[model samples]
Target: MYRKQLFLLSLLLMLLQTAAFAQNNKLRVEPSFWWTGMKDSNLQLMLHGNNISTMQPVFNYAGVEVKDVVKVNSPNYLFLNLNISGAKPGKFNIQLKQGNKTVHRYSYELKQRAAGSANRQGFTSSDVMYLITPDRFANGNPKNDSVKDMADKLNRNDRSGRHGGDIAGIIQNLDYIKDMGFTALWVNPVLENDQPKVSYHGYSTTDYYKVDPRFGSNEEYLELSKQAKQRDIKLVMDMVLNHIGSKHWWMDDLPTEDWLNFQDEYKTTNHRREAIQDPHASEYDYQLQTEGWFVESMPDLNQENELLATYLIQNTLWWIEYADLGGIRMDTYSYPDPEFMSEWTRRVMDEYPNFNIVGEEWSLNPAIVSYWQRGKKNYNGYVSYLPSLMDFPVQNAMVEALRDDEKSWDTGWLKLYNTLATDFLYPEPENLVVFPDNHDMDRIYTQLNQDADLTKQAIAYILTTRGIPQLYYGTEILMHNSEKGDHGIIRTDFPGGWSGDKVNAFTGKGLTKEQLDMQQYMKKLLNWRKDAKVIHTGKLTHYAPYKGVYVYFRHNGPEKVMVILNKNELPYELELEKFAPQLQGVKQTTDVISGKAYNLNQSKLALPIKAPLILELK
Candidate 1:
């Protein structure tokens, strides 16, 4: 009877201990690790556990102090305001207790930062960026195509399904990108998007701190950044601050009741971009534009929450330092609260002053795009520290000019010329990002009615025009979609990305003569622009189009280069007298493309038919 009673008591104790262990398993901490040295001394550590707010926490670590503990309305969450200004690189622990008994102990680590992390250089006008959709770029590892635990699986045939492109594929093709003379690479978001389907685009983020297993591991992403840097190529990360995937881990158990906007209702956004800048806009309309969700699948983030704001700002800084990122391309820039975005951009710039961030404000109006760029003196007295913005005006105008059938004051080439005339509205127009087309639009070739000559002219304009130039992948070999405005077809897989692909662009296996010519033309133009200092920061002077010819000069000090866009099928005589201000004292000109020589002593120069002339004068 004594032995039986003793065994029963021991079993009872074991059961109680097992229950306690299960309860502790619910505890969680974000940003699992941080660096010891940082510009800001304050660090807000968000603690999550089962009824964690009921406990008091204490830690005794040299150079680290828990200044305050904040408890919100949620019993399962706690925020620790820690001052780690004097902390050294090491590990420490904080004990959470309910009175005398210790409920849990959390271990934290601080790491040493990389060399010159704060002063890292960012993408600039001198660098031409190559934008890529990783899922459509290339597939290097077949094994990681369909991760078991991930909800989505590989289905290459499905336009929107995961097509098995991974970081390894990008690494394999780094040489191809480098040899093409692109100095910077902008990859679409690669964060964990654990949605059940259509998650390949990566905009719907499920995990903020983790890379999607379907794409690759976080370490693999770091390896990619390291390798690209070694080849003198910079990496630009795309980040979304407006919303997150509906399947996000926090959606089921949010940190706070106000974590998401319009949580009680599922109202879609008006997408009326002018609401942000409209003078007579109703408060209700502005609220609807800012507070409404982007889509049913994406829940809008409420940046007005101070805690959430700090969380996002820290998250971006962590990635910048962790991945050693060269720049950040923020998605949906104007959707968030302007005050919070201003603070966010200011904080990031404070940390890395030299680093650049290009915000996406997709309005075709120059005034709307200029409002977000830094140094714009807005009429509303709003200040923005954002360094760059996507030049949608230039992009739209260029396409219209290419598609127009006739040349007139407001048609054809003048459409583009008039669009650029508004440059005075921007404080730093040269910092804008200009491109012909991107993943979101139809390919440039398709927009030009598949005319190779017009396509070459567009490409030449994008490469030589002021501001940074970004080319979407597959543009060189003339990739286009059969149907217009189909994003899935527009972001088609690179020919050689997958296994068993008959044509290999990397090896030039089965490309047509025109495709090969386009590829070589791209290679030459890009390679030359890599060393062309005048195009990077030169003053621009353009003469009005005269008889189907539009001419412009990019000159800096003594260096001079002229670009001519001619639409006439037959050769036209261009009078040198019209460009006296730009072409004065110029004796001879050599074509940068064909190396053909021209004498300025003649009164008129014969411009080639439908040819883009990039001339270097001496």
Candidate 2:
């Protein structure tokens, strides 16, 4: 038991030591010296000092008092955990004296502790992530919009340029987001982007260690996480390890020539994601795609370089520790060097055991996306430690189904029903991050042909089904592109983001009734799901598609939820006893969105055409 206790104490000390390195990076203190935040009055203070093999604490003539001391495991790695004595509640310079010469003086500031609340620092699969591009979202702080000498000047007038939607703007809207029932929020890369044109998207990272001053200071970000935590909202920080903005500070002074991977000129990715996981892939295709730069403006990172690897690893660890991020959404995850990428993910998992991270591998092939998931034996024998992957296979399936045939199992709407059938490919099907439309794709409502009923049904399924659900911002109102393929129009400004604006989803002002219902329905389902443990941690069982109606079940031991997705224009009567035997005892249920009653046992009720239904057994 004593040995076990020592092991835990040693582990805690190691974490403190790792964090201490970032404090100032100039300290050569002995490893034996450590501090613990344990509140027990009886604490241990292990010490190692120069010029003396051993030491003891003794009080002086001044009302100064010293606590107990204990020898620890390491001669150099000492522990310092002491009981409070006649010390005042302020900054004090404590002197460590020896026989002839006193070598150490430590300045410590002691303050009253907080109420000791628990921090919600990690996320689970049930969270629905809402992605936002800071500059494109809203401009709440215009004061810091443009700096006089900044190379990347602010351009509100420029459609592709930066509009100052600072962190302050995001903080001001957490209430609105929480009210909308989103469990997690993922903003685009908020690090400093010193790039010249089109830095507005916040993806061109200039500095990984610091938050962009154009948004707000690091302190403001911390406060945002703190506030979001109170509402049980998890913050998923978007990170890009593959590349950095060309105008980054590192460009002026690189730590090494090999800081970037095979980078010299701007080149587009081969866009052959299949080559990375294909058994018959060519070596030339692999090297050109993974090792190449996105463009002349974005330099690919050299994960193979040891120094570069450590720098990035340390930088990621710093953000997770500093902001207490719930999870990470790694942008362009497949573009990095595969082996070192595994090491980077493994180190993060080693440091944060309970945390979850998702990588964006945009592919319609289940095998391709599944290859990145943890514990998969890829075609190349590559093993990854990544926890979750975006369910792009299902996303594409959904889009194809919306456009093509719905009945045939080989393609179209049947493709979506068939895609979930391959859940065996994923290590944890429940751990995937599911979404309708994100910042890059067309809006969900638009993709569903702007049918309010279909949009509502998609929300019902995404909220109650397995995996973490990420709702794109402005999705509730069916925001879409005025033109078919313009991404800029797809990510339009939220109406009330600017002054003298008309529509505001926050207040339901000037919105159509259908739009309001869309908002309410999403908020209703998500907020209700916030407390549904069965839905969050349940085992999912899906049935094959029948006449364009898809059915699935989420069961946790005995409690279960039956979700039905009907895309047909005609209402289909499901015989409860036939097809899906699991729906046997299901009777009365409360439809999450409308609070309406549904009776499924020994009865035939017409399921709304092209809508979804969540029926919980009463």
Candidate 3:
């Protein structure tokens, strides 16, 4: 009797311990939920838990079939592939079973997609994009400045530290943005950047699905999209596919051994972007460029891993569907595997045929940048599906043209004229994104040596040039950086972003005379471009630079406009006889900026010094 009682007590204790262990373990499903009506009828769920590979998933729903169960080297992960071709929008239960006992039950849901989600229009030449770094734009919610769970806290004194800016700040200023004549808003990354330091820039992403609590919730981002659309403004999302933050959840328990490039050890990239297109390059150099990590804190993603590639591709589609994004700006476009990038863009473009995605190649060579644009017939048989690329070549030439002296053919305005002549290399030159400066570069005012007139010329050229135009925040108010090559200072806080600030650019309070004048100048130019169809889709004709003057014309049918850029210290008379083809039937011209009128019948027209003259020819 004593032996029997001991055995029963021991068995009871064992059962209790097993029950407690089961209760403590929690299962996690990536893409916790999905939607129906996706163009692709396939779905892959990554299940993570303590030794989850030991069990099998079993589910029964009409039109939903489990096609494959993939188990990687890790015992904590299982990739369940399903073909949900005809699945209805509803909820179903998935059971993880050990023998006959069910250990975990997960309720999976299939949501209904928004109507006409796939056919949404993307930002184009008809729209002007306004770029803003959310952390320095404004502070709408001070409570989230220092999240208890996130390590980085608000430090207004520290230039690199996070401020209190949130999505709510942007939502509050939609009226101001709309009033400025900007039709599209491209904000820096707002996803979760849980790094211990320097999280203000938002380049590092720790979570793929969640927005940073410091910035706001994912719902707030959705609200931004909704509110922006109401104001007739499109929202462009900045995305990074090259790497992820070291603190990402996958780093703790990797689904596969090859999930990250150089998984066994840390190796920095050589950053030899040209190696990919170099015909005589060695395989060793190419591998290091594509597979090496960006930095110690950013783990380079291995898109070659089929499972990981599918996950990333699905993640991008999810955001486009969830947030209703107008376009995408892909960062570090040349760092990833070329084949994988080709497939990535193909998948996205297939789903949304009308969507546009611009990539950041950062190469000054038009040949290098043109290689990534769609419809390019490469000599090495490389195919790309990207719709557009940042026109870095033109940007560099424009800056040099404005600052260099016109003493030689290779110097001054000739550099800009030569760069524009290279447009034949691009598949669709009009689709490229042209800008005077961006967040990564020094402000245009600072780059132009604090000369407001040269800055105005740059803005005028970008707004009138072919392709889409993007203006950085505070550019309208002549924002400049005292220290060059410093990202923190370059992206300084706006005057009216925070409370108690003396100057508010939004309200034009406490601003210098020059600052207010530039603000009005930008307002007029932007609003004028909003309705200028000739500039949007016109045939560009140019007369080579003579002395210190450069001339170009934008003409569409009967509508015509002449642009003259002068780089002289003194006003001079510009001979109009050389532009007879374009000026043929012209009688009078009105300046778009000063609203001053000029007669075009004379052979000579007076041009201002160091200023841009946009004349509406009649």
Candidate 4:
């Protein structure tokens, strides 16, 4: 008995000693693993631990060479630049040694690249993206609502609090989204936002590589991509390269002094985006606009630091490869160093030539927004490789056009016509992502003052326009905010997402007649758009607004679509003579909305009052 007890004590001591050793050498490696076959032969691994910079890393693997070891000001971090040009799919141990003894051993893995990952296609004009805030969308697993380690807790009553919606919730609603005629899913950032409060928005990222535990694991995010792809729905990830949550792991022990802009101070941005392209802008204004923090809780990253830039670039690539993303919606695109952003997009596009990335410049001026597009000839010699940008000018104009009264030639639909006329500024205006409203703005329904007819007109205009269309989650149901410009209210929870809810938007339970009608109306319009090739790739020809009516045609060879927006309070007979160029041989047209036939042989066509009309020219 004594011998047995002694043996048990010895085994316990050995286990405790092993645990202690692991605890002492615990290392957090950004990009925990990598794939073997990437177009970019180089990979930068960021290692963070207790005094890890003091030790030397030793590893031996075929076709994998540690080209350089970069140590920053922090004693706990080490950046390893590896050349994996000829590396095969396998695993090897990277031993961190103190003198001759290996103090820590990290098992590094090189995964095989997914087939055709390099040439994966991105979201385009053909797709109608559904923008979802995961935390407000649904709650599939209640268990992960309030993770023990995360600072934020579940509180559905609080508009800005975490509401337990996660990856599982989105997974559960995939069918609904597919049936609704959306081909792309643009989910807000799922990265860890371990903030003490208001972390539900996901704009403040705490960890880049890991998905928030409240949302789900990184595997689940990959699963979302898989399931979305199966339904022919592309997944566009929302990324933030400008700033990070204040509680990020690196904040406690920054890798270097220049890791963050204004590292020792907190200064909010002036938000003067024009300074970037202004020829006479002062250095002070330009520096403040680019380097200042977004908010006190969000630290602006210093992309000028080569190591930090490489780290961010690698993180983006890692997510794209891991999640098999269809595209990326980079948040606050102008806030980052333009030079770094150019390089970032260049590297990403170099690896995946066909992929798309849309940046949010949030400027109402077309010239300002156009400068960031890929092929624009800027006066400042600033070149960009970015493929797409959010069409903020068009969005603003559309909203104003729908709401403004036709008191003068410059009011109402003329606003939209004039705005679109400036499309000549963009190198590829068709590639832009046009929307009625997004997560950061007032809900479209509310913006239109809850006028369902006006809302329909806005929706029809966005869908038929010459750019990729994106709609918020509840826009179809006319979801409106009681208060304007409140982000939390703008991104309210979907009615059917939560359990035991009185009204369920998903199941069409207890919805009002207007809501149901709008839902069905959007369904029919979207499905029709799904097969409308002319609307996808056609050349747009728009006529100036006449008598509170805006007319446009999308023509591709023999296929043609005529979209008419009538804001008249009474029925108006549209003179067909002006549109004869487009309706030359058309005798009759089909209403895409109501599926009714109208004879176009007459000199005039009667249009309903205050309604939008989409006619298929046959």
Q: Best candidate, TM-score-wise? A: 4
Task: Please report, as a residue range, the 10-residue window in candidate 2 with the lowest summed lDDT.
Answer: 29-38
Off by over 4 Å in 2: 1-121, 264-267, 407-412
- 123-146, model 2: which lDDT tens digit per residue? 686677888877766667888787
Residue 328 in candidate 4, Cα distance off native in Å: 0.3
The sequence of per-residue lDDT tens digits that candidate 4 reaches over residues 48-70 is: 87898999999999999888998
Q: Assess the local accuracy of residue 433 in candidate 4 as a C-alpha lDDT between 0 and 100.
A: 97
Better of 2 and 3 by lDDT: 3
Pairing residues by index, what is the TM-score of model 3?
Answer: 0.96
Clash counts for all predictions: 0, 11, 0, 0
Estimate TM-scores for all models: 0.95, 0.80, 0.96, 0.97
Residue 269's lDDT within candidate 2 is 71
lDDT of 3 at 114: 92
Report lDDT per candidate: 0.90, 0.73, 0.92, 0.94
Q: Please give the lDDT score for candidate 3.
A: 0.92
TM-score of 1: 0.95
Q: Lowest summed lDDT over 10 consecutive residues: which window, candidate 1?
A: 402-411
- Given candidate 1, what's the lDDT at residue 251? 87
